[model samples]
Target: MLLLPLHSHGQFQTPLGVAQGQLPQFRAAPPNTPANEPIGGWRILPRLNVVETFSDNVRLQPEALQRSDFVTQINPGLVVTGVGTRYSVNIDYTMNNLIYANLSNFNRIRHQLNAMGTAELIKDFFFVDGRAVMTQQNATLFGAQGVNNINVTGNRQNVNIYNISPYIRYRFQDIATTELRYTRNMVSSSSNALFNSQADAYQASLNSGTAFSTVQWGFNYSHQAVHYERTNRTVEFERSIGNLRYMVTPRFGLTATGGYERNTFLSIRGSPSSPTWTVGFIWEPSQRTSIAFNAGQRFYGDTYSAVATHRTRMTVWDLNYDENITTFNQQAGMSGGFNIGNSLAQLMAAQNPSMSPEAIQQSAQALLGLGLQGSFFDPNNFFSNRLFLQKRLQASVAMNGIRNTFILRGFDMRRKAFSPEGVDSGLIGAGNAALLNNTRQTGVNALWSYRLSQLTRANIDLTYTRFAFLAVDRVDNLGLARVSLVRQLPQLLPNMIGMLEVRHNMRQSNQPGLSYHENAVVGTLSMSF
Candidate 1:
């Protein structure tokens, strides 16, 4: 399976580690640190890539004129393998640009460079495994000609960051495992490091499983303490799992599972964060068909809060079906199903405490005992539909063991936004905050792909969106597209890989005034000893 690990560098994607009733997969390629010692790894490979992009100079809209730009990127990477018994290492240095409308106008020049790696060591006995590891990432960003992009997320300025993490892990009889990790970030920007100082995160996990003649059961727990630049925030959640398995016969078996996670947010004096909940399910009918269902509630905070926690809830379902055309895994086919039940979000309204006594009282009371009834408990409902198909073929030509496969994916989503319209008015306007009625977004997407040879493959996918609301239009006619090719056969190249990839992104605004398109081409070359 292909693994794509994410860094904690500020992302909101929900993770299943705390829900599977199992240990988080503690597998990652480590970077070179503690210079003198040999940081073991599984295998080693170094890579370099270069790309150039040129946008077609076309008019965008009547109000928002058409514009075009050019960009170039250089990516260098290193991957390591075979560590303390078994482990891996990874490193990368990339140069790119940061361009946006609100920041530095259009086609802004930026340079970003990063060097990161990880190392792991482990020992086991009975049914338990003990491990220790460390990871480090250093990044530097510089703007064109030395001018920086004012946007916070822009790597366009003269900024540098170094993150260090050390962790320990233990597994009990393949049923459960836990980890103790500490992470520190050191950043130097145009301003003082006070805002760029160190922060830490604490995480705990537990999992267990029981297997009987015809049944299986499980449970899980996880909690994290996050502190950003000295602000302590508590994040805690737990998940439960239960499953039932049966064998109809020797060739086909069926298994079903149910999972749930509970999240809670405590209101601090400065800013209040809300708690949430999530539920999901998985069903495997046979070797060719599998399905999953997921529903969740999230959050959005009020003003004065640097972050908005939008409490949102929604349900989703998906199914996959595959058909083998050849006994040797030749011709094949697949179909899928998808659906979302509903969605809702909880919105917060902030009041200026410095206002007059009477004004403060009015605003405070209005936002306090606040309870608005609606279909989507939150301000919006995010829904989508999805389907896909796949096909595979064996070599029809040379004796070369080459094979090919293809896939197509389609998706659509609908969304609603209902936010407060501001407090009502009267002699002491203190209690009425109506919700938005005409705010919504919707869109569709299409994807296609092909894999050829024992080491090469390519694919292309695109999306179009439309919105019910003007500003939300782009959010509603368009998405992005990706096309890439990969080829790697170690026995033939002696630990070498050759790859080329291109991606095109296009979007049309719901308002018809805002649209964008971009193209990127990247080539890669790597070798290992």
Candidate 2:
């Protein structure tokens, strides 16, 4: 089990698909609120949005059988935020009602929610964190992907995740700091209920205090047990580690770690219990640049991890690589990966240090409303039921200018099954388990945003992704492009915004019945009070 600190409102990593560049239909803050000052109590904002879309390939079918149609969407939403002495909360919920002109049978309503809260119960010793998320995702990478909930693709499925954690922290007199935490989490899917699961995790850690400046040491332990509803099976993971760090200089350090891990799973190899060890180094020459690299040995085999980051006045660069043994339920419930909204906000804040947090958040939301954000290439974990060994590499750079902003991101991910097949089935049946046994995905995304004026902005986004099934000798390539214009309607209403967008989507594949092309135009009007 990997123990990561839980945040109050961490960003959620979601999968990217064709035509995913559509703008979010909600505003960040109310018009009368002050950007520089924080709110004292809870404030609720209600909003309504109407969208009309026309697509030449509404069904994403081949050119010979393509059809066109109009999709009308009416969405009502709410946003709530609060900050108090000991607690803070944030919530966003939307109910979408869709009506299709030519495909009325496919019309449906969907719900979306993202909420999180944190409270300090004992001043400085005890704290609690909670989060709930309801969203849609593609059920399988082999199926046709939908851009949003409005699409009629059978691949779309609703996913719900809930987590709550409580922890205690204490300090020994000038010696060390200790923390103990317990977490409970649940994950469920509407269409793929066979993969539903619940897990309980416990963790404890102790680290040296300021007394040990040159030589620091730490101890950590974690345990987790997961229960699957369909299989009526339970899996357990336990790990313990002790680490030491010696500062060679003010800016460089050497580190060593030794650990033991045990797990209950059907491994193709021998028993999955082993002693783990790693040697690493950390370098931080300045506040704006840092790098960390580690090489380790685990039950699976050789393991490696690296993280490097650099920041400038107008640009930010990040690179990360890691190999781990994880399950879909754990990744969806706890892992905090790359999120475009949070990345944009960080870039904007870095570029304009004088801007307030609320101002930077609003600016990022405005850019997102103009379809200026690009999705990162995340690993596909939507259809897996067993544990897997995953290795992923990702890098991104963002640059902000007086009149333009640019973001570029690339990723490569590979996965191999560790648990035996046919024991439990995911969305894919046991007969077709080979598709998920060994897989790889590689992709790149680029986005450009230009400020036309104080009230209007233009954006261009491009993305390319490739999926490979190593066992089946199948591969697919998907490409997407979007151009959009957004403007604030202060003359019409103080809280209104309007947008127009055009998109193109195409897919090429070695597998039959998986190739298609689409063109779409969308117009939206949103108002909040």
Candidate 3:
């Protein structure tokens, strides 16, 4: 059946259909404090924000505590426009500091400055767009350890990322649009406590279509180079993605996607390639119900632990219902990946190692536990399909009217694991590490917002997630919970906007106080002309 998800947003007006344009973010903003800027010939926005946070969990739950953080930002941009002058430039500066009161003890100071520019050129109906940004992430954390787990030894990682890219596009008078783009990213985690990596990729593609009746097609080429000395490993990879979308009508659409990737091991690696293909459809039988189906195949190459190749097949289905302007979506699917190869036990026995009889038996047991292994992502997992419900309402407060919004999203999925031989020994190691026999996971996310006034607002966001999976013996379960509260003061003071936020995180496992928790507060003042 054909599916067309009914959306009140007047169809998907994604920016890819329009020229290059975006909003600005501060060059200097305290941690978790956001700075926004406009990218185009038009830049006119007044802004102010403040953020701060404190926590006392350090003594009770080291992992769940945050000592303090503060940030302040200020920025404005210049818009350049004309036939050949469709460019925008924005500049920002930031100052921030933090302290982590713990046995390891931590203190930090940061100063950042940034400049961003975007260009959109239209020549004789042909179009081209590009962006250039430069940033310096500098920080001084007392007594190094560079955010390390241990309390001793000082470690610091400094990174300077420079990004510059330009794309050329061709917009057919009445047919399609094609573009070519290139990007480079690198991070030098030289500090003893951090992981360093480097990567770069390029993409070339074409998109053809219009709403109601249209199609999209493209080919992408990319390369990823990475080195993690801390992990004692390296990987070199190349990947390609190609796909197409066909919209038969306003109420029905079909899409097909195909991709392939190959990775060469620099230190310890496995199969060099993986390929996947998928086709799906969307049908909107009525304004109240939506339906969808997808079928695909995936190959997950085994590197560290695999006796042979592993391939997975996937199938998915989804249904949705709406009433009173409220909508709900649900989905289900099945998928699995597996691989079989020569008996690993034979390989182990073939080797000659000097060891005691008991040691030999233990080693033999580890080999026998491997059996046939499987490794790959199950695309059919229900989590890929979710139900999101949302509504808008108006309210009255303190002599002024306000608007409120509410949203909820949920997902669940179960998957299989590879053989014990293919498992990473880290989590279970000497204690008995083996591939998961089966795994199940479920998650729910919620959001609520209230506009107290034209200049002041409040928001609450929360998420709850649970996990259940296989082990050599019985099933293991885990859960995570997170909550955040935010207050927006666009006019905390004239020409200044401030944002304050606090968050709490809890995880369920044998470990109670090892969960991640953070709190941040920041403020910004901006003046635009």
Candidate 4:
């Protein structure tokens, strides 16, 4: 109950050994859109980073007493990317070895790896995509940041995630289209035996290729099957939805959707079948702004979903809110960031069928800007884990200028267990009771990076998080702030960069003696070839 899941969408602070998987999405491209860029062939990047750090409180203990440590870290990494006319591949591997001068027992090595690729197996009719990630994760929700591996209070766990997806699409001459998709996702944890699970999902969809001047419609059906390794529990979900839309004008449209969902776990609550309906409006004031909102009644009482987005030459903003019932594993995935970068790349490829993967990546990065890239991965939960009922709201803002980039993100999520918590039966102490409980999480994160010169840059990051265990009446607050400066040292060595950083972190809780604070300074030298 003390663990806060890591954001799985990006490379930031992702522990060593985890591979990143690509979530599959099916959508028909607008007819006649042009491809965005040309393929750039294959390239490989190799780099090394060496860091030295000094900490006043290596163990993150309470202020009454403290321990100090000087640590050194060496990281080496390699990246390979392929951008072809019909496919793309990216692979990254890195290893970090930490050495603690005063505390040799705390030394360890961490490995991280991520690989992803897409292939047009049958020209324009069939495709395959796959990804793998191996990394480490924090075992607790609070305490020190996950990056510090020296004498840390938060237990560390090894995790591996991977997935493969294949899909087929067919278009009927400017009138209609159909798609079929299948994906398999697997998760395993070395420290937590109860979390090992495998999930398989299948989907089929059909939509109008060309909207009649006043109407457009679509139908979708999807099924998911899950299996837990240790508990031997199986879960299944089947859903079907149909959508109808009528355009009253060019700028506004009305939408109506109806669906039914069946869940094996939901049957425990008396009924496994849920009938749902929603009515909403779609508004597009301009090419740069759009909004969609809907309200409906479902198995869990009143339900609503809304999304709004606006984009300018230098700024991008998005807001979203949704409510749903899912499993605990799925709820964990839902709490993280989305993979907008991949969607953007796919859209670029669709618009420019001949563009190379490298070109598509470049164009997407340019379009979304560095601050917003990869921030849009899990919007509709098409690629998450288990089943639980949850209400969530998230918002993000990104702005890029000639010399500076900034990003701000905030989210609030509340979840309740759909099933009674499982009892440990014979277990003793705190382990005897059920672990899962209703909880709420709210947090805000902000990052800013400024280019001080052609070869120098500075950055700052700040985060605040609050966790509330409603059923347990426990709450905790955590804060982190970091500032760093990086300078490219091409004059001394090609592709070399030097950095200096300072960090301060604190955590407070209602429980006595459960709080701590720490300060650290670090210097690093990195080189790429």
lDDT of 4 at 179: 95
Top of the candidates by TM-score: 2
- Predicted candidate 1 versus true structure: per-residue lDDT over 259-377, tens digit per residue: 54343334222222234333444444554334444344333321110101112111112222221111100100001112111100011011122222322222122111111111111
How well does candidate 4 score on lDDT at residue 236?
85
Predicted candidate 4 versus true structure: per-residue lDDT over 320-363, tens digit per residue:
88887775345332213443344444444544455445545543
**What is the C-alpha lDDT profile of model 3 across 27-115, one tens digit per residue?**
22223322222233233232222222333332213453434322222222322222226655544333333344343234544433344
Model 3 Cα shift for residue 315 (angstroms):
30
* lDDT over C-alpha atoms for residue 384 of model 2: 73
lDDT pick, better of 3 and 4: 4
Return the TM-score for candidate 1, rounded to 2 decimals. 0.43
Once fitted onto the true fold, the runs of candidate 4 whose alpha carbons sit more than 4 angstroms away are 1-40, 142-151, 211-213, 266-272, 331-387, 423-436
Q: TM-score-based ranking, best first?
A: 2, 4, 3, 1
TM-scores for every predicted model: 0.43, 0.90, 0.48, 0.81
Backbone clashes in candidate 3 total 35
Each model's C-alpha lDDT? 0.30, 0.74, 0.33, 0.63
